[model samples]
Target: MLQVGPDLVCIELKGVNAYLWTGPGGPTLIDTGMPGSWSQLVGDLAAHGVKPGDLKRIIVTHADFDHIGCLKALKAQSPALVACHTVEAVYVRGEKSKPANPSVLGYVVHPLMAGFQRRYDLGVWQLDELVVEGHVFPEGFTALHTPGHSPGHMSLLHKQAGILITGDALSNHKGKLSLPMVLATPNMGMAVESIRKLGGLTYETACFGHGPPIVGGASQAIAAFAQTL
Candidate 1:
């Protein structure tokens, strides 16, 4: 785990990572990992002398299964408010808008895994807050509307730490920095454009949902990754 700022603590899971930002108001848990990883997540927090049940809020970057599998589990234990973008908020609350299946490649793989979510009755969890651009959290953090991977996708920016919590808008998976999965995006153009905008931000850390974090030169790295689109 890396403490990027006074309030921000990042915990890296096997395939993805979640960020915890605590202040006078308690803690906000970023993305939850894939299904069946909740035990490990809770255990890790316990090991660090933090209780997952004390989380103040749970902020979802987007509504992918891998990122939200533990939403209900976490909510059941904590009184923390759950927040997501308007577009994604509906899905989290069990209202199906549009599944994010984007390409033939994704269609084949998505259904195989999505079936489990359906069978398990993993409806979208409820959201207490709708995050958008200009929404400011404690400690000088702002939400940036970085859409296209999923409509209303959001990234959190901490001006003080120069850190941007990029859900799946950008990735370091497979040992290289790149854009989100093309086959999983609703609009590749919009995703690329979003990346370009984030690329211009003055951030030193780019924390992602998958793989490792980018420690510095965020603006240039993001721009270069967007260029690949």
Candidate 2:
């Protein structure tokens, strides 16, 4: 678990923590873990002083298998409104399953994923609200559309906390590379551009999906990461 600011705690659940952030009225959870993880997640939340029913919003950065895999389960347990970018709404709602790249390599492996996808019963989610530029979230947070990992992918920016919850835009794990996450989005160019965009922002800490969060010197870390490209 990592703390970006006084009230914002990012609990990394080894698999994925249903991130909970408290506000004036209640707490907002981001990225529910895989299904059947409710009991453990609840235990963690309870330990942190948060209850399942206190969740206000379930903000999914993107509709990747690991990111939003537990959305349906969490929504059923809690009344939190699920939200995602407009481009990803269909996938989040299960109306459209994840599409594979048409590349030769992609075709070779797409068939292997059929069973896994079926087992998860992955579905698309509805966009309760669209997150665009200048959108303020509860407790002084803002949403930034840092796509490329997935079309319409987003990252939450906490201006007051100087923290950037980068979905998969910039990974600090397995040799930091300014590129699209493996098996995620296919476009590498878009991924690089997205990282550059994030580098321009003023932030002190960066939280990622896979690697450990970068606590300080965000600009330097990003610039150095760009050089590795």
Candidate 3:
């Protein structure tokens, strides 16, 4: 676990990351890591003197397998309100399975990948606490609709803390800020557009779902990366 903001702790589970928001109106979670990552998430919460049931809410950036892996289990242990983009609620409810990435490789690779989740039977969930662009969360964040990776992919801007929780709209993998994996993203075009959207924002720190946080000059870093797109 790593402290990325005044009230945010980054919890890395394998290659993906989840965030714990400890600010006012919080004890909220940003994302949950892959399936079977419940123990890891529990450990991080414990370090902060929090338990699974202590969370006030669980906010999902999107409905990816890696991101929503432990959401159902966590909710079973805690009555935390599960929040996600209104557009993605169907996928979360298992009413609709996510579509394959609109790429040649994706057509072949995505189906093969579904097998992994099938083995674990990650259940579906739905919630009415939906989000939209500019929606202010009670935990003090302004929503940003950043699509392409997934239709309802969202990011959160914590203006007070000067931080942004970038949920795969951008990745700083290995210290290089760039777009998500080509195979993982459904629409490269919209992803680029989302990067441009992030560039226009003001934030000093940026946390990612797939990489370590950029502590300072985060907005500048994202802005610079967006120009190259």
Worst 10 residues of 3 by lDDT: 117-126
Show model 2 residue runs off by greater than 4 Å.
Answer: 24-26, 111-115, 124-126, 174-178
The Cα error of candidate 1 at residue 41, in Å, is 0.7
**How close to the true structure is residue 161 of candidate 2, measured as C-alpha lDDT?**
73
Candidate 2, residue 41: the lDDT equals 71
- How accurate locally, in lDDT, is each candidate? 0.77, 0.69, 0.86
Q: Any residue pairs clashing in model 2, and if so which? A: 91-124, 92-124, 92-125, 93-124, 93-125, 94-123, 94-124
Model 1 residue 179 lDDT? Answer: 72
Which model is ahead, 2 or 3, in terms of TM-score? 3
Model 3 lDDT tens row, 89-145: 876765655667887889988876666556556655647488889999899989899
Residue 69 in candidate 1 has what lDDT?
76
Q: Rank the candidates by TM-score, best first.
A: 3, 1, 2
lDDT of 2 by residue, 1-229 (tens): 6665566666665555445677543488777666566676777778778776777888888776677666776776777766777776766766655555456776666555534555687674445776675677765668788767677788878877787878777666654544554455656667777888788788888777666667788867886676666
Off by over 4 Å in 3: none
Q: Which stretches of candidate 1 lie over 4 Å from their true place?
A: 3-6, 23-25, 100-102
Model 1, span 1-229: residue lDDT tens: 7776666777776677888777545567888877778888898677666786778788888877778878888888888888888767766665653354567877776666556656555555567888778797754568888988888788888887688999988788776887788767768778888888888788888888887777778767887776776
Tell me the number of clashing residue pairs for each predicted model: 2, 7, 0
